[model samples]
Target: MVMAHNPKIQEALDARDALASAITRAGVQLPAMDVRTPWAADADEDEEREGDARYALVHLGVCSASVAVLLADVIVRGLTS
Candidate 1:
C-alpha cells in the first residue's frame, strides 16, 4: 500500500526514517540486522566479537521498534478500513 494515502502511517514511517537518518548522521555504523542473525547459541566468542554482537542487538532493537510501529499501523488500517 502507498503510505502517502494514509497520513498516520506516513507520519510514523517518516519518523522512523528520520530516526534512522539521525543514527547514520551520528556516525554510528550499524550492520544490517535484517540480513544477518544477531546472536549465536555458542557463548564462547571473544570480547570483541561479543561487543559486535551487542551492537547488532542494539541495531536489531531499533529496527524491531520501527517495524513494530509500521506493523501496528498496517494492522490498525486493515481493521479500520
Candidate 2:
C-alpha cells in the first residue's frame, strides 16, 4: 500500500506522543485527570497567553480522545450489526 505524508497528521501524532509522555510523567489519564496547563490564567494578556499555550498543547489530547471514542463507537456498531 502507498502511504501519504501529511504534515498536519504527523504533527498531531507527534503531539499525542508528547502528551502521552507527559501524562505518563504526571501519572494521570487525559480523560480521568484534570490536566492543567502551565500557562492557565483567569483573564488579561498574561492569562490569554497562558491559556492559549495550554489549550494548544492540550487540544491534541482532546482531539485524539474524541477520535478514539468515534472509532470505538463505529467498532461497536459494526460488531452489533
Candidate 3:
C-alpha cells in the first residue's frame, strides 16, 4: 500500500528518466523540478494541497523505509530460526 502520494511523484519519475537519458548524452545539465498538484474534489483535498506535498513525500519515504526494515527483520528472524 502506498502511504503517501507525493504530489511530485510524477515529476520525480520524469526526472529519473531524464537523468538516464543525460547519462547517454555528452553534456547537459537540467534544472530542478517544478510540479504542481491540481485542485482536488474531496475532503482529503488536504492531501492534494501544495504545502502537503512535502508531508506526503516524507510519509512515502517513511513507508518505503518501513517496508525495507520489515523485510530485513523477517529475514533476520528466519535466519535465526
Candidate 4:
C-alpha cells in the first residue's frame, strides 16, 4: 500500500537530518536518534497520516554519560558565548 505524501513526516525527517549534521559538527553522536512514531505505531505504514493527531516528535535518543556531559558543556558554552 502506497501511503500519501506527508509533509509532517518529511519535516520530521528533515529536522532529524539537520540535527544529526549539527551534532556531528559538535563532535557527538546520538546512535538511536530518530522520529517518534508512537502515534502511528499501531497503524499500517500506508495508513500513517496526519489528521487531528499530534505531530511526530524528533527523538534525541540516548548517549553515554560522558557524551551527555560533553553535550551539556557544548550547550553551556554556546549559551555563554
Candidate 5:
C-alpha cells in the first residue's frame, strides 16, 4: 500500500526529483541523491508535524573528486552563462 506523504515531505520529494532530472540533463548523475526523511521513524507516517521539523532534507550524497569538479563546473557555467 502507498502512503500519502505529508505536505512538506511531498514538496521535498518533488524538489529532489526536479533537481535530479535537471542535473541528469546537464550530463551529471548524482546516484545517491534522494529525499531523506529522518523523522519518519520517530513520528506517525500520516501526521503532519508542525513548524521546521516537518520538512524532509534532500541529501546530495558524496561523489568522486572528478565528479565534484564536474558538478562545480556545471554550476559555474550555469551562473556565468
Candidate 6:
C-alpha cells in the first residue's frame, strides 16, 4: 500500500538543508547528529505517540533554527571586523 507523503517531514528536511547550507557558507561546521528520529514514518502509529514525537521534532527544529541564526550573526560580525 502506498502512503501519502507527510508535509511535516518535508518541512523538517528543508529546514535542515537550509541550515546546513547557511553553515557551510559561513565556513562553520556542525557536529554529526548522533540521534535520528523517524518523524514521518511513525505518523501512522498510535495517536498519542505520534503527537509526542511531532512535538519533540518541532522543538528540535526550533532550537536548530535559533543556532542557525546565531551562526549567521557570528559570521557577519567576523566579516565586519
Question: In terms of lDDT, which candidate is strongest?
Answer: 5
Alpha-carbon local distance difference test for all models? 0.44, 0.45, 0.44, 0.71, 0.74, 0.51
Q: Please write out the lDDT profile of model 4 over residues 1-81, one tens digit for every residue.
A: 111245565677789999889878988888888776545677766666554223566889888999888888888888999
TM-score of each: 0.33, 0.33, 0.26, 0.72, 0.75, 0.45
Error of 4 at 25 (Å): 0.4
Q: Write the per-residue lDDT of candidate 5 for residues 36-80, one digit (tens) a residue.
A: 665656777665344334557788999988888888999999999
lDDT of 4: 0.71
- The TM-score obtained by model 3 is 0.26
Q: How well does model 2 score by local distance difference test?
A: 0.45
Worst 10 residues of 6 by lDDT: 50-59
Tell how far residue 45 is off in model 6, in angstroms: 5.8
Q: List the residue pairs that clash in candidate 4.
A: none
Q: Model 6 lDDT vs. the true structure? A: 0.51
| Native-to-model Cα distance after best TM-score fit, residue 47 in candidate 4, in Å | 8.4
- Model 6 bad stretches (over 4 Å): 1-4, 33-45, 48-81
Cα-based lDDT at residue 48, candidate 6? 33
Per residue, candidate 3 scores C-alpha lDDT tens digits across 1-81 of 222355455455565556536433523322332333333564275566544543222112223555456545655766799
For residues 1-81, write the lDDT of model 1, one tens digit per residue.
222334444454565566567545644433442213234554445633422433221123444565566656655766799
Put down candidate 6 lDDT per residue, 12-68, tens digits, no spaces. 556666766776787665654222345556566664342233422222323366666
On TM-score, the leading prediction is 5
Better of 1 and 4 by lDDT: 4
Model 5 lowest lDDT segment of ten: 46-55
Q: Give the per-residue Cα lDDT of candidate 6 at 71.
A: 72
Using lDDT as the measure, what is the rank order of every candidate, best first?
5, 4, 6, 2, 1, 3
